[model samples]
Target chain A: MLDHNAAAARIFTAALIVIGDEILSGRTHDKNIAQVATWLQVQGIRLKEVRVVADEEPAIVEAVNTLRARNDYLFTTGGIGPTHDDITVDAIAAALGVGVEVHPAARAILEDYYATRGGLTEARLRMARVPAGADLIPNRFTGAPGIRWGNIYIMAGVPSITAGMLEALTGTLEGGAPLLSETIGCWVGESEVADLLRQTEKTHEGCQIGSYPFWREGRTGANFVIRSVDPDRLAACCAALAAGLTAGGRTPVAGGL
Target chain B: MLDHNAAAARIFTAALIVIGDEILSGRTHDKNIAQVATWLQVQGIRLKEVRVVADEEPAIVEAVNTLRARNDYLFTTGGIGPTHDDITVDAIAAALGVGVEVHPAARAILEDYYATRGGLTEARLRMARVPAGADLIPNRFTGAPGIRWGNIYIMAGVPSITAGMLEALTGTLEGGAPLLSETIGCWVGESEVADLLRQTEKTHEGCQIGSYPFWREGRTGANFVIRSVDPDRLAACCAALAAGLTAGGRTPVAGGL
Candidate 1:
């Protein structure tokens, strides 16, 4: 396990690789992007970028290598299951230049799990396979555990199973202070306050302000999300931004419209 | 407009670039990925890849250049709004090596739109700005239209507005035959039928079969999706797949389980 307190000074960032032909084909709407991103944020690690690629081997290998090399951590969801098409393990193993073998602990777990349900057939045993030197991320929902190999975590495509893996991973990986954000909504065009947002962000170091405009109920409004590592600084920035909106004759709504 | 029928012999592919810091921060759940991918499929274009980047100019520019250079078409959603943070236009212009200009027709639309609501203020007029030599994709919901420059499309981040822009673009871009797919579900583990899928796909040229496994009600099941450009071939392939699954002692469910 990484030291959370020792890594407090450095900001940890992660990249997510969504691997599935179903997603690219639009047959499946991905819930993992939001789920993983939200989970990583609470772990105090920023999800910097996400790439959705087809289940092809070359695409998966390229994405895993590129993303895992660049970010502090890389998470992959999908293509790890009891199927020939589920080849994320093989692809990632190839990318890492390691041969895949069935982990004994995982095999035992799956054996015990399927003992009463059904005998462990060859197909069911495929779930025990993992890349060399990989550890397991426990999945309470299913017997097939997630793979964690040197900052690269491979999770299941199923939303429920992925949730279980994430639940077991809580407080295991090291991370810095979680980012805090406050949203101020105003019934005004975001362009109208472009300078104010930029100036406010400039005035506060280590803060980013994002303006999201919307047209709803025959009216235009924008939600300004102010984010910072420090909660006090985030609150102060939100207050300043709200003051700026009020000075411009627009009432700022707490939360968002 | 590109002639869709003329490009029937070639395969057209597209890449999507999702721009927003809110998405990375987990503040916003992206609805555009599936929407754009589905729309592209209807246009006979395969959505090959998607990259989610922050609201930064260089990141947007890099993604635009990389994806546009590789794919037949590139679609970008978000960051093109009446706000200072909306720098997609500037980034795309920089990538295309063109100057940013106030499109006269776009300006006219915004002027007429704001005439009854509020006079076109400086901030509102910002919507008229686009990369030089870009055409507009009309927005029925909002006056600020989407942009089309060469093979790149700049669309609104908001899902509704993006839908409007995609609606306007229907049948305009040239593409090959739209890919057709059929789903067959079986109450058996995917690995049990891995060789069946592989052999089925191998027998049917131009067809790809993807296996997605699920665990429900204490039983395992899998959905096999077969995709092909030829409808007759796709139907034939599905028949073979269903026959194979039945041979393996699994009842095939139509339209998936």
Candidate 2:
């Protein structure tokens, strides 16, 4: 496991390669992008880009190669299954310039899975093949473990399993302090948050303050949101926002949040 | 608007450029990617890529340039609202190498909207500024219309409205026959699908047949999905799958699909 606490200050970037035809066909809603984006952000890593490609080998290989080369980390979800459409291994193998081999670690895991689950056949063993010189990101959900090698993390496309595997692998990553955010809702519209939003940013340098206009109960209002990695600075900004809101006569409660 | 029929036969490609901090923060689940993917798929246009980016101008600018340059069509959603986080217009301007101007046609629509909504301030008018030389994609939800310039089609991130706008814009683009697909479920495990899946693909030279392993109701099975632009070819693959399943002692239903 990597020391996540020590790597806080450095920049981390990731790219998601969503490989599937169902997603492109609009039959399947990708439940991964936003989830991955947020997880990376809170971990102090930036999800720099995402690419959704069809199951085509060339497209997948090209995407994996391009993104893996450019970003600090590449987390790919989808295309790791037992079916014939499951070609992420081939694509990744191509991307890394390596041959696909049944990884011993993954093979042991699959054997255990077959012992427990029963009826898992050699076709299921296809999931055991990992590119040369790769380790596994333990799949807590099923037998098919994901691979992590050279900044590329290949996981499953299934939403529940993808999230769980990512969470399990969280400790392996070096992360900065999780970003903290606070929000204050007001009857004020964007126009009202405009001045405060600008002032808030100026007063709290290094923090991001944004005005969000929303409609609720037939009334137009705005939510002022503040985000920063610095905890003390975050609290100070909240205090200033509460004071400003109260001074502006908006009955600021505990949440200038 | 461009002629829809003219755009139908051409193989149009799209890239989704999502701009929002909420998405990156996981504060919100982005509903735009799947919607656009489905819309483009049904239109005979392929949604080739998707990128969910922060509201940062540079990120949006970079994604716009990349997606637009590579694909035949590019669709962007979010960040074109009436608040501080809404920086899509300026980014699109930067992407297109043009100045940000209040598109007269779009501004007229906004004026009419404010006349009724009663909270239309100058800040609200910010939604009216589009990249110079862009045309508007009509908004069915709110009056703030999405815009189109060059190869990019920009729309709101909100699902209902984004979908409505996409539906309205469908007739304008040229594309191939929407990729047709046939899906059949079986109780046989994914291993069973492997041989049949390969055979189906081998038989249908131009079609893509994907076998997906799914576990549900204490039974592990695979869904045979055959996709192609030609309807006859897709049907033939499905027929072969059914025949193969029946030969293997599993009575496959011809069509519950």
Candidate 3:
């Protein structure tokens, strides 16, 4: 009951569900959030929001359902390894009201991978399981494949494996133009240029300006990021914003202060 | 309407709302998530979930309301600066149905901070604004003090400032026993010993084992983390798990692989 034509013209967005108790426990510094967000940007899709949930089934299911329903695509990282704690596949199946079954192709791949080192034991075989009706997201870095079911893409918790899966998925998903941005850093307080930022963004069509303030070396500064889908408009907005900063008696740094 | 007696015995949990577009845009790598999570862990409070939202009021309001209502406490970082884009106070006020006002103590702190530098300009004075009925969480690093409205704590976006606020508020929040953990690293694939992990954890009550697999130096391995609120139980669980790994022909690394 959705209009495909209307969806095509609109911007594509994605939400990332980071599944791990280690992250919440502060034992593991998460590297997936940044990598996924950057990859989504390169694919011309906006990373709208991110939720880091625990390994619990209820938490995973709730996040998966909520994010998948709202965004054009939903990607999850972590909890897909071959161990007792790796239950992302099962959780996804439960969330989608489907049964989990071992995919033969994934089984064959794992079997071949472990044949030389060690035979695929029951524990290792867990990697072959996937939700019914899901397809394999080929992982070039590892033999255990990622999963792609509907709009949800289940990837590995490891940063390298997730990067490989993202590389395989490049240019496959339909997306709008990649968001173009320019940063204008100045040594002036952002509050002093609040009106200039507002007016510059308002004058530029389809552009948004974000002011990030920082205090470094006993001095205060801010980086103004101007973003737009169009490259030319982004440049124009950046130039105008930089000029405004100059007129306000601050020398704007090209990249950042 | 709420049962205060029932809440006193339960474990204290917190949810963090990171408010900034720079983070979602992949332009800024967030350091606040780890800092807050670690701080909460040290305080004996569990970080249950984290949601990163944009600077938009609707997103901030929704996240604040959803998290603050469900968890024992809600902490928000970013968007508490002096720029026009800093709208956390406004959004939080809207969510709590409170009015925004300049706290006299906060204003005095700002005046003292900037009196020798540039005096209290309107832009610098913006940092003193807070939601009505909220008390100040002292910040030794910066003049802009953090805000505390009931169970919600509003903090600065900068990591160092947030750290100062956290240091000042330490030992003030009521918390249960701090969670203790032990990491046992093995040179074998975690799937090969999944049953061992499950059995070990099942034998040890109040302990949960998490298997984090990794591929390094062209070899597959995993680090098994054992966690429990009781220190004695945590030690016992680690011993049993280590014995299991050793019997299975894998030398357990005491610290990590």
The alpha-carbon RMSD over the true interface for every model, in angstroms, is 1.6, 2.2, 1.2
Rate residue A205 of model 1 by lDDT. 83
Clashing pairs in 2: A183-A257, B4-B171, B7-B173, B7-B174, B7-B175, B8-B174, B8-B175, B9-B175
Clashes of each: 0, 8, 0
Summing lDDT over every window of 10 consecutive residues in candidate 2 chain B, give the lowest-scoring window: B1-10
- Of the candidates numbered 1 and 3, which has the greater TM-score value? 3
For candidate 1, the docking band is medium
* Per-residue accuracy of model 1 over A68-183 as CA lDDT, tens digit each: 99899999999888766788999999999999999999999998988876667787788899999999999877788999999999999998899899999988988888888888
Q: Residues A150-257, candidate 3, lDDT per residue (tens digit)?
A: 999999989999999999999999887788788889998776787788789889989999898888898878899988887888989999988888887889999886
Candidate RMSDs in order: 2.9, 3.6, 3.3
Residue A83, model 3: Cα distance from true site in angstroms = 1.0
Q: Per-candidate TM vs. native?
A: 0.94, 0.90, 0.95
Candidates, ranked, DockQ: 3, 1, 2
Judge candidate 1 against the unseen true structure and give its global Cα lDDT, from 0 to 1.
0.89
Q: Give each candidate's fraction of reference contacts reproduced.
A: 0.66, 0.61, 0.69
What residue runs in model 2 are displaced by over 4 Å at the alpha carbon? Answer: A1-7, A115-122, A246-257, B1-9, B116-120, B251-257
lDDT of 2 by residue, B144-222 (tens): 8989998889898767778878987987887776878878877776675677777778878768877666667777766
lDDT of 2 at A121: 75
The CAPRI category of model 2 is medium
